[model samples]
Target: MQKPHSINLSFLAFIGVLYSFQSILGAITFQGMPAVFRQSGIPPIQIGFIYLLMLPWIFKFIWAAPLETWRQKKGRRTNWLFLVVNSVAIVMLLLLTLTTPDVGLYFIFILLAIIAILSATVDTALDGFAIKESNALDKNWVNVMQIGGGYLGSIVGGSLFLLLVGRYNWKFAVYAMVVLLLMMLCYVLFQQQSVKELGQKSAKQSLQKTFASKQVQYGIFIVVIAQLGLRLAQGMTMPFFIDYGITLTQLGVIGSIGGATASLIAVFLTGLWVTKKGPGFVLISLLAVQISMYFAFYYFSEKAELTLLQASFLLLSNSACVAASFVALYNLLMRLTSPEQAGVDFSLLQGVDTAIALIAGVISGALVQYLGYQSYFLLCALASFSALVALPLLNKSSSPLKVVI
Candidate 1:
């Protein structure tokens, strides 16, 4: 393992800002739009198909190696790619503003798909940059930026966007997003430091070698088991809220105020816990909390009536657990990535994570429709429990391959 590097607060802050841009788009496409569609009377099954828009993220590893090579050959930093991709994404968002659900729903979906592809590309570049810049000791804070900034973006894209749409109009909401993206782009362009290059050795790294590592294989298995149930349960949350008579503004308020606050706190604390106790311990502990939350959600779903306060409590608590678990999981994956092929290795792990979550999300709505919310939540709990049972295997697998950190 490499000796721990000195922490650079400016670089971490830049990473947080960069990740916020990607997550803002994600929150809008995945969370905000789904609630809007559900409110517009779209069926849950049809709403489920929205997960497919995120397919680029699931398979981005296919192109990650080539992109990394291209960057190395050109001697261009990841920040350059980040700027270019986000610029295209901004244009795509502008195009989306021309279309509405009433007349151009399919067009809007198509544009969002293009934007997802751009955002996934940005994620690939950003992950590689973060891995290269930070050493093992400070990597937890890197993930804090990734997950914490993500929650912050969710407040803007998921919560604030909905609030704007409810109070003003769709175009106004979208224009707000456009302005934010432009500001992020400007910030990146003005930054003085270029990412340190990976040089000849990294340029020689291949995806084949990355996949063959035992650590990579074990990481894949752990991610799939840990994330699938959580994503499945989360996929239905907004829809369930809509069906349960929660208004759009109320959902926005919950996410903006309660959800963001709880998630940020959880992310920060988990960063500290993972630093002190290690990711494996933190993951198992948080997974237990997540399982309990799922069961609580199950109990709530069966109620004849749920008060706003009750719903807010459940959502906020679950948000915190989700944020913490993600921090731990990403910390583990970061340790699995070799710096030589950081882009390919990390992208592959994240790709697997996204693929499983995407599948679960795609089917979650139909399952909820078929089995009802109570049964669906119970099923999610069982899935999470199975992951908890399998956690020991992750430890066993780690013995064969020294962690790359």
Candidate 2:
């Protein structure tokens, strides 16, 4: 049997770097390409079909049980699976770079969907590993790194990658992405494994026990409702910017840089704040701030006049708030998991959160079509406010917020 490995700060940082690059890779396919598609005259309805690509994420929990069961069999657990899935994703990305989607959007979307599945698989494994390995203090940092890395990835994948494509060509941007992915892959290949040996427990029983816990049930509720409004608002943002005359290159630079900056700030700020105040307070406060951001967008949208600086400010401020909320929410999530069933428990919670967000994302275009941008923005604010319903559930005396699972 393998000895349990203590969580290390350096390994957590390494995961941050890996996650950042993963986000970059994901953004290249999701964020970057969607902008290109819209720029090429694709309508919102047609482009909204692109959200179907997220199908894998919506159902990734289906594999979580198998992954957990496999962990019990010993021998490096899901690390090899992670490697294999990421390798496939890299290959798919290379293919995407070689093939021009302008000729047939269907083919590219299908290909990207495959890549999303593989990426989600890798993400599931990595997340499970973090939950299993990290201590209470380390979980806060893990959440920070996750969001911070994602924002950084957005800068490179969404901003810089799009700029490259616009300034040079598709091939140039794709080659840059290839190089980044290669570097990420090298790290994954060499990272020291710390996964502990699993006991012979039924994955199904673990999941049932997790769901039976009221804390986890409420935690899942918060996770889903918390993310839904944010995803809905963000889903239409690129289109909203384009309507206000923000070009792809400008958006890439402004939006990405601003988001990354705000995210980094939120990472550090929320880390400290959550440690002092508890994740519940941090979650609720930041979520309220996020609601305000949506309304702010509605006000600006109604004015029908937006400067790059103003837009950047709004996006950056909102990104900071959202990042803080997300970190806090995840901090709560990690605390809810039982380490013995970390993979299944974490995946179920994350899967539901992702599935709801993806559902909102897929339907956001239709909402925009029917309600228009300003109305849609207002509706998103209402959705964000809905998360407050879960607050009372978190206050159960039996499971105090600060107590680590």
Candidate 3:
């Protein structure tokens, strides 16, 4: 038998850099906006437009389908990924040099929209790489790599970067993003992987090919159904976290530090647990935990102590849930993929989930605005009913893949 290959260290490090870039890019513009955007003369609605700029990501899968269908001279997906990364580098550099503070909201929105468009594409390429590079043995570890990078990016960018954005000018923000994007680009170049090894398929064949697989289709159904419920419920509650009594910066700490730290620990620990039993029970357990945490969002008070404690518990549960759910997703995605269509398959999964999130985000926003926070949480509780809806579909079929207890 041929020796099994490990995920090369250089490749994994590259994965970290890319994942970190994804977390930081959206967050730097979104979460740190209030600190930077002056409501003074400009209406808050203008800043709201900046948030809307991220909408392209909701539509990212349209382009993603082509990514899976197109093949380079080599069968590897990296060619597409390389293009996406280089584009991001050039775009970020351009954004830095163009000073926008004095510009009209329309121009600022257009510039921000361009950034979102390119960054979202970069994300699609990176996610495709995450799915393709993982193997049976390294499946759980690969997820940890992805999640760790996410948490690191959130902390480094959301918390640390937000502070920096506060103290420094917008030029520094532009420079920081450019530096991160370049680091990731360098990592990809160094991996030296061929197209076939990275499983670059043309999007034309990918959707058809994905449906052709009974297993992949079933996995998509299960994953999407769960995502629909989890995301919808969480979306309903999350908008209120920083608005009702709780301050944005405090919520940021709870989310960035509390959530990241807990997720980091849970992921590594659950990596060991998933070794014993399959991910079936772990996923279910995590969903329940997240639902419980969602309820806590309703009870949060502005008082520092109660808010801190409630925020802390919610963070712990949310992080743990992320740890468990993503590990299962990573494992299942890795198990089901063929090297030929790995990038396409992963993008499809993300595309499906993003679709769910988009509907949920819009609805949740409208509901909260109309009905208020308490009612929104009530709707969230109701939406979580889909967890039960997904359970029957999630029935475990034994995977013949090898694992250590």
TM-score top scorer: 1
Residue-by-residue lDDT tens digits, candidate 3, 1-405: 213455555556767766776777655655455334532234333433454555667666567657545533344445455555556544754564466455544555566667777777777667666666564227667777776776667555654554444456556756776676676666666664522343323334355676577656656665665676566554433334444444445655666667677777877777776666666556656666656655666555323344566656765676567556777656655566556566556666666666666566556656655676556665565555566556644454442222210
- What digit string (tens of lDDT, one per residue) describes model 1 on residues 129-197? 777667543677888888898778877898778878777888988999999889978987876354344
Error of 2 at 146 (Å): 2.8
Range of the 10 consecutive residues with the lowest summed lDDT in candidate 1: 192-201
**Candidate 1 local lDDT, residue 123:** 91
lDDT of 1 at 213: 87
Error of 2 at 210 (Å): 3.6
Q: What's the true lDDT of residue 21 in model 2?
A: 65
Tens digit per residue, CA lDDT, model 2, 322-401: 67777888888888877766767777787787777677777888888788888999888988888765565556556544
Candidate 2 stretches with Cα past 4 Å from truth are 1-7, 75-77, 193-206, 389-405
**Cα error, candidate 3, residue 92 (Å):** 3.9
- TM-score between model 1 and native: 0.94
Please identify model 3 stretches exceeding 4 Å from their true place: 5-7, 29-72, 75-80, 83-90, 93-105, 166-174, 184-205, 233-239, 245-255, 301-306, 393-405
Position 346, candidate 2: lDDT: 75
